[model samples]
Target: MLIRSFDVLPAIDILDGRAVRLSGGKREAPTLDGGDPLRLAGRYAAEGARRLHLVDLDGAFSGVPRPELVRDVAAAAGIPVQVGGGYRTLEAIEAALAAGAQRVMVGTAALSATFVRRAVERFGDALVVAVDVRDGRVAVDGWTHTSELGPGELARRCAELGVVRLLVTSAARDGSLAGPDLPLLREVLPAGLPVLAAGGIASLADLRAVRDAGCEGAIVGSALLAGRFTLAEALATATG
Candidate 1:
C-alpha cells in the first residue's frame, strides 16, 4: 500500500476532569482510567503525537463546556489540540478556539444546515464536524440520540457547507477495538472530503488498515490507554 501523510491523534476523553475511555461511547460503559488529563496530554506530546484529540464527556452530555480544562490541557500539551463536546453553537465554538483549541468539533448541532453554514463562514478550517454513526444513522447528543440522517448524507452536507474535515466514528466499534469499520469509511469517502477515523483502532495493523482505507488520520483512545501499542509504534506504522 502507498504511504501517505496520515496523522495519529492521541485522544484524551475527560470525564469529571479525569482521563477515561468509554466503551461504545456510553458514559455508563466500562471505562479505562487514564489518570490525569493534563499529564496524559503532556505525555502524548512528549511521545511524538502530532496532535491531541480532547473531548469533555461531561460537556458532551450536559451541553455545557469546561473551557478552563481545555485551556489547561492545550497549554500543557504544547501541540495543536482539537476539542469536541457541547460545541453546538457559534459562541461555543468561538469559546473553544479562544480557550486554545486549534480546531473545534461540532456534533449535535451539525444537523442544522443553517448553523453549519454560519459556522463554516465564521470558522472555516478551524471547524470539524463529527459524523458519529450508530446503526448506520448519525448519532447525536453524545451518541444517545440517533438521527434520521445517514452518514453519507451528512458527509455530503458537510462537504457542501465547506467543512474542511470530518471525524467519523462507529458508535458500536468505538472503544470495542474489534477493528475499524472500513466499509463505513469507504462509504463516507465518496463524498470527496478528508475524514479522520475513530473507534476500534486496536493495533499497529489497524492503523495501517485505516491509512490504507484513505483516512487522513485516526483518533485512538482505548487501545493506546490499554497498552495495545505505544504512540511511537502507531506513528511509525501510520507513516510507513
Candidate 2:
C-alpha cells in the first residue's frame, strides 16, 4: 500500500460569529477568540495551510449551521475548507456545499448507518464523518452527550458505509495541548481508513508522533492559536 503523507489542518471554531477555542469540549472553559473568521482563514492560508478545518460551534450546539458565515469564510480562505457541526440532513449538507465548503462533515447523523449511506451516495467523497471520543465512548451533541457506541465500532461502521476518511478527535483532549491520545488513535486505525487525529497536539513533536503512528492528517487548534508553534514549523513536521 502506498503511504499518504501527513497533512496539518488548522482549525477555526466559530461561536456567535467569532472564532473561539473550547477546552476539553467544555463550552464554559476559557475561550480564546481568534478574531474575524475570514481574516484568520486568510492568515492561515497565507502561512501555507492548503486545507482548513472549520467548526460551527453555534450550529453544533443548536443543530443549525451558519451557511452565510461558512460561505464568507470559504470564499475568503482561497483554499479548500471542510466544514462540520450540525450538518444532520441532506438539505443542510447541500447548503454547506453550496456555501463553498469543499467537504461537509457530519457528526451526530453519521452514527446512523442509513444517514451515512445516503450521505455518501449523494456526496460521494465530498462527505467526511467525524467520530469524537470522550473517555473511550463516542460523543455527540457537541460532545455534551455520550453514545453507547465505542470508537472502534463506530469506525468499522463508517467504513462499511463507504466513508473514505474519518476525522477522529479526543473530546477530552481538545484544546488541552497536552498531547494526542495515541492509544485511542490506534484503536480507530485498524479499519485501515485514512484517519485525521485532532486534540491535544501541543507541539511539532506531537505532530511527528501522530504521523509516525500512520495518521493521514492532524488537526492543530489551541497549539497554533496559543503561539506554541508557527504553521510553517507544524507543516514541516507533518511533511517530514
Candidate 3:
C-alpha cells in the first residue's frame, strides 16, 4: 500500500456560532473571531483546502457538540470534515457522522477502554482519537483536566483498539502560534500510527517541520486566522 504524504487541514473552532481560537485550550483565554463559521468553512473549501478540522468549543467544555453547526459546515465546506469536542456517547458520535462529518474525534471518552472498544467496533476508522497533550500528559475536558496517562500509552492502546488516526495537539502550543511541539509528535509516533498534528504552527517553516516529523496532516488555526500566512502558502509547505 502506498503511504499518503502530509496534508494541511484548516481549522474552524465554533463558540456561540462564531469562529474563534483559544490559547492553550483554555476556556478563560481570550478568543479571536475569524468570522462566521459557515462562511469561513466555505472559504477554506474555495481556497483549495482538502480537509477541514471543525471543533465545537462549547461542546468540548460542556460535553455537547453543536450538531447544527457541524451539519452546516459539512454541507458548505464541500470537503471532508472531521468534527470533534464533547463526543462521549455512541449516539453523539453517530449524530455527528450523520450530520456529514467524515470522522468524529473523541478525547476524554478515549480514557475508557470499554467505550473505546465499543466505539471502534461500531465506528471503526471513522472514530478519531483526539490526543491533547499538556505537560507531557493527556489533557481532557477541553484541555482543562490533565490525565495521569502518558500520550504514547494512550496512543498505543487506541491503535490496538483499531483507531486508524489520531489528532495530536499540544495544549501549551495551541493558539499561541509558537510552533508545533515536535517532541510530542516524536513521543506519539512510536505506535506507528497515522497522526494529524494541531496547535502552535506559526509559519511555513513550522508546517514543514511537522510534515518532516512524519505527521500525516497538520491542523492550523490561529496563524491562518491571524493572517500570519495564507492557506495557500501553508498547503504548499505541506504538500511540497
Candidate 4:
C-alpha cells in the first residue's frame, strides 16, 4: 500500500477544552492556547486534513477520557477522529468508536498482555499501539513511567498480538522543535511492523525523512500548529 498520501493528521491537544502544547512532554508547563479546539479541527478539515489526531490531556493524566468531548468533536466536525488517552477498558474503546472515532490508540493498556491481546482481538487493526520511546526503550503513562522493554521487543510483541499500526514517539524530542530522531527509529525497526513516527518533526523535510526511514506516517503537532507548515502543504509534499 502507498503509505504517504495527501493526508496528514492535524493535532489538537485538548486540555480543559482548549488547545495547549506540552513543553518537554509535560502537562504542567505554560499551557498554550492555539484557541478553541473544535474551531481549529474544523479549520483543518476545511484545509483537507484527512484525519484528526486528538489527545485529552486530562484523560492521559488521570485515566479518564473525555468521551463527551470526543463525541462532540467527531459529531460536529464530520471528519475521522483517531483518539488516544486513558483508553484502558473495552467500554472506553467502544465509546470512542461509537462516538465516530475511526481508531483508538493504545498506550498504558499495552503494559498488560491480556489487555493488549483482548483489544487487538476485539478491535483488530483499528487499534494503534502508542509506543512512547526514550533512549530506544518504551515509556508509558504520559511518558512518566519508563521501562527496560526495548523498542524492537515491544514492536514484535505488539505485532504478534495483531496490531497493524504503531504510533512511535520520542519523549526527549517531543515539542522541542529540534527534529525527529531518525537514528533512534532506525535502531529499532521490528521487521514488518508499520510505525507512525511522532515527536520533534520541525519541517516538511522532517516528514520526508520519516517516510524514507520506512515509517507508515508521521504526526505533526507544534510545527503544524505554529505555521511552520500547514496541513495542506504537509500532505501535498508527503510524496512529491
lDDT pick, better of 1 and 2:
1
Candidate 2 — which residues are off by over 4 angstroms?
none
Deviation from native of the Cα of residue 153 in model 3, angstroms: 0.8
- Model 4 per-residue lDDT at 182: 89
| Stretches of model 4 off by over 4 angstroms after superposition | 1-7
Model 1 per-residue lDDT tens digits across residues 162-205:
99899999999988989999989998988888899999999898
Q: Judge candidate 1 against the unseen true structure and give its global Cα lDDT, from 0 to 1.
A: 0.92
The C-alpha lDDT values of all candidates are: 0.92, 0.90, 0.90, 0.81
| lDDT over C-alpha atoms for residue 75 of model 1 | 92
What digit string (tens of lDDT, one per residue) describes model 4 on residues 122-161? 9987799888887678887877778888777777788777
The better-scoring model by lDDT among 1 and 4 is 1
Error of 1 at 126 (Å): 0.3
Residues forming the 10-long window of minimal summed lDDT in candidate 3: 1-10
Greater lDDT among 1 and 3 belongs to: 1
TM-score winner, 2 or 3? 2
The top-ranked prediction according to lDDT is: 1
Candidate 3 lDDT, 1-240, residue by residue in tens: 123788989999888778999888887785578889999999999999999999999999999887787789999998999999999999999999988999999999999999999999999989999999999999988888899999999999988888889999999999999989999998898898899999899999998888888889899999988899999998888778
Candidate 2 C-alpha lDDT tens digits along 168-225: 9999889888899999999999987899899999988899998988899999889988
Model 1: what TM-score? 0.98
Give residue 120's error in model 3 in angstroms. Answer: 0.9
